[model samples]
Target: MTDSLQNLVSPEEWQARIDLAAAYRLVALYGWDDLIFTHISIKIPGTEHFLINPYGMMFEEITASSLVKINLSGEKVSESPYPVNPAGFTIHSCVHAARHDAQCVMHTHSINGVSVSAQKNGVLPLSQQSFFVLSSLAYHDYEGVALLEDEKPRLVHDLGDKRFLMLRNHGLLTVGSSVAEAFLGMYIFEATCMIQVRAQSGGGELVLIPQKILDMAPAQITQVTLGMGGSLAWPALLRKLDRVNPGYRS
Candidate 1:
């Protein structure tokens, strides 16, 4: 590891690393991971730094020790043999910089996510799963692979004051104050898209929930789940990951 990472490894940082690694593994297990393409990153505790997956490793191969420490500019603060991906960090860094409440940022290019993103209406309120996402979601049109520095302002602008962002014709993103929150947000977002896609495939009129009801969805969802959607779901996902790929924590 780099001296920067050596000095940075505290209890909180280790926890962040382990949780982020577990998230990567779990996303892979759920089929949300797109090879080594998409990324999930967590802010380094007590610093402006963040932890991200190394460039070449598949999600299942990401151990806590393997995650690279990087700053907003995407330079690897960790002394790993692997390099960091500047393109991947571009999307993540914009959210982290714009949303101080966001400690973890998860992005994915899953087929379901891309499918929904391509639709002109974006995320329609077609299911219960859609309510959780529609209440606080935003959309950003794809700018041809997210590598340009010029795109940051518009991307952040489109994501203003929202936890979830659907990249038009691209993929999905969720930001949270904790890894669990971000992971759970993505879970709900992906489920909404999957359900919509499956429902549309039925070739019948979608039973979209009314706008008035959708307006009350955030509170209603909280009431139904007792605000434990993340708290409850995250552990179960971890257990699933443990069964399939327990080395993430190591």
Candidate 2:
């Protein structure tokens, strides 16, 4: 790491690196990784820059040092031997710029996520986990690959005031003030999609939650963690990641 990188890497940044890398490992372990397609990015400590996985690295191969630093404009800031996907950063940059509270943003193209996004109804409130997502979910129509600068405004508009975004015919996205929150949101969002897929496969009557009950879900889930929020799930997830792929932290 260079002196500038050393200065940028605070205790918080170290923790973020570990958490973000673990998330990538866990996503790969769960078979949710799309080779090198999806991305999970975290804002660097004390700067407008963010850390993203190297363009060509598999999710399981991502380490703290393997991550690349890039500005919101998608310019690489550090002397990384690895290249970055500026087009991949397009969606992430929009969220980072629009949502100041969003310290981390995760995007995935899992089979389940794509299946759910392709559905006409999007996310249905069939499971308890669905409530947590449906309460705060936003939907963005797919405009092919997310590369055009013009897509940013529409993406921002669709993602407005929501933490979870379902990119229609594309995949899923979640944002949080911390890496943990973003990961947890993706977890629930993914779970909801998986459940919906399996349920539809059975061709059985779906038990959808009432809209009134769904409306109360966000507050209720928040209350369970006492406003510390997804940090409750973060520790346990780290423990799981450590057992499966401990190299990510290093």
Candidate 3:
């Protein structure tokens, strides 16, 4: 099943599969996977077609050729031995339809992320990490496991043009023009939530970043990364993945 996929797909799509597969493994590496529940999807460049994980496979077990290619309608468009998850289909398809710029969409159910989502205020600007999230964050109230097709519009509306979404009482989602960008977004997002959780556990007065600094976070981040955004860190992350989980490109 895996060996023949390379011959079947364009080089561009093969690369997309490899990168998306790497993302799935990295999510597992970072302890964000939820037993095949959450998903990370990426569109094949210049097409409505996208790749998602083979349903029921653990993230670490995913390989580039193992990803299932499908259209926005949740129907498989290529040959694969695995089925697609309906819940994953429901969430990712709408985001892809609404935001063409979102080439990749990643979702997670990490403890810290869910913990913050369960909070009423959601993603407070208590740390520097939180600023990036707060600047472009939106919240969507969980509508009982994300299975219904009717929930798609509401999900798209709440997401709007934001890069980060806190699925209230559920988890976190981030979208980007590339898998690297989306992974970096999730890194910052999870880190922010972890910081928030740790700070709250201290039981002391949390000093919020002043509104002035918070307002400048977008520029500050651009300056810090020299406008590289996720591309700056993606190579290093891939190198890390190569060392730890090297078969993602298979």
Candidate 4:
């Protein structure tokens, strides 16, 4: 099945599948998955098509050949032995439709993330990681589970060109030019929230990063990464995955 699926798509798309599948496994490895809930979607480059997880599969169980290909409407466009979660597509499809630059969209219902989302201040500039998120964060008040088409417009409006989105009373989301980029963004986002939650529990006065430094984070990060950003760490991440969870590439 793996070989057959690999043969069915272009080399570009197959690589996309492997990267996205690896992302799902990495999410699980980090203990961020929510019992088969939430989603990470990657748009097939230069096409309106997308690849999403098969419904009912744990993130650790997702493989390159098991991802289901679908069109913008969330309807399956390929012959797969699995079904998709239509409700999951509500957020992903909307993001893909509105943000052409977002080749990958990742959403998570992580405990630390949701805890931060429920906070009135959202992501505060409490740590260096927070600076990366605050520099590009947006917020959307949760309007129930994202299962309606009408909600898409409001969700898109709230996202509005931002890379990180805090779904109030819900979770965290990040969009990027690739699976690696999106995953890295989420890592920073989740770390920010975790630090915030821990700091709040400490009952000590939290010293925020100065506004000037916070403002300079984006440019500093660009320089530090030499413009490679997530791609710089992606190969290493893949190697880690290969050692810890090896089946995603299949």
Candidate 5:
């Protein structure tokens, strides 16, 4: 489908496609994709439009040229032989509408993520990675399968100025200024959930991080990650993908 459009889009839009497609591939690589159920979206550079996975394709099967471009209204801007899940658009559009900083929005129904979401405590600060998440985390109570337009306001309200969101009884969500940041944030968020779940299995008292330390996390995060930013590790990830399955870049 993207074959004929190669001469149609600007270079920047095409690059957005490659990176966004890489994100989908990475999600599948880490087993976060919910068998074509969950969605990840990226706003096109210098435009109000965004690119999302074509409905009905497995994450691993998604290619750069095959991504569907849509406006804030969930209407398609690109020609494609696929349909999109309105539920996916409903959730993504709301957040994109409110958060100007979030160029990429990623949602996952990973097992560990949903496990922690259902917990009354939500995300706990039991692991080192949890600190970074807690520094910018928010929680939204689940309100069914994300199809209603009215629910958009509440979801954006709960997500106010936050990068990480735990949808109670649903799953995990991360928004980023870029695709790499969103993917990296989800990686940590999912890992934190996995660690917390395993820690609870021993039935031992969970020693929580002190509030003072949590307060310092927002400032120390760059130092902790050595100022790599989110995309620092992205090249390595893409290289890894290339070794295993390079078709996503097509």
Candidate 6:
């Protein structure tokens, strides 16, 4: 299957295929999958075409060759045996259209993500993880299940330059200039939500990180991680996926 894909797709596209497939597998690996409900889209380098998981396949079942390529209008630019969900692509399409700097868009409905989204106060500065998320977080009020065309502007408007987006009353979304960044951003975002929910469940007074400290999160994070972005951590994640689900590369 990989050989077939290599013959059919350009080298860059094939790598994108593998990276996107790995993301699907990782999403499922971390138990973030919603049984084929959420979608992840990545723009193909040097083209307007983007790749998404084919509808009906669980995230764990996605593979490099199995992904479907579609244009911004949700139209398939290449032949794919699988179909894409128009309704699911609605929010994804809008984000990619508005954030040209964003090369990858990831949407998830992890239990904690939705739980926190429904909260009166979204993400708070309680834990160190929250610092990274709060630094670039934005919230968009839910506008019903199906994302209408008019809603595109408002959604993008809310997202602005933020990497983390909380779809109020709905779920969570992340955007990145690369697949690695989006996945890494989502890891922090999702973890922040899970930790916050559990910490609050203790029903005791919580100590909050000072707002001034949070203001230095960007520099601190870079220092803590040795100035390495998601790229530095992504290979290790893929190796973990290979140990559990090597089929994603197919």
Best by lDDT: 4
Candidate 6 has an lDDT of: 0.90
Error of 5 at 48 (Å): 1.3
User: How do the residues 1-250 of candidate 5 rate in per-residue lDDT, one tens digit apiece?
Assistant: 4463456789888888888889999999898889989899999989999899899999998998889989998889767888977678888998998998889999999999999999998988898889889999999998898988899999999999988999999899999988988999999999999999999998999899999999998779877674326868888888999998797777
Local distance difference test values of all predictions, in order: 0.89, 0.87, 0.91, 0.91, 0.89, 0.90
lDDT of residue 108 for candidate 1: 95
Tens-digit lDDT string for candidate 4 (1-250): 4344788789999999999999999999998899899999999986789999998899998999999999989999988888898888999999999999899999999999999999998998898889888889999998999999999999999999999999999999999999999999999999999999999999999898898888797798788875327988899999999999898888
**Candidate 6 per-residue C-alpha lDDT over 95-121 given as tens digits, one digit per residue, 9 for 90 to 100:** 998899889999999999999999989
TM-score for model 2?
A: 0.94
Per-residue lDDT of candidate 3, residues 1-250 (tens digit): 4674788789999999989999999999999999988999999997889899999899998999999999988789978889987677789999999999899999999999999999999999887788888889999998998889999999999999999999999999999999999999999999999999999999999999999888897788788875427998888988999998898888
Error of 1 at 119 (Å): 0.7
RMSD of each: 2.3, 2.3, 1.2, 1.3, 1.4, 1.5
Off by over 4 Å in 3: 226-228
| 48 Cα displacement, candidate 1 (Å) | 1.3
Rate residue 116 of model 5 by lDDT: 99
Badly placed stretches (over 4 Å) of model 1 are 1-8
Clashing pairs in 2: none
Clashes of each: 1, 0, 0, 0, 0, 0
Quote each prediction's TM-score.
Answer: 0.95, 0.94, 0.97, 0.97, 0.96, 0.96
Instruction: Name the lDDT value of residue 205 in candidate 6.
Output: 99
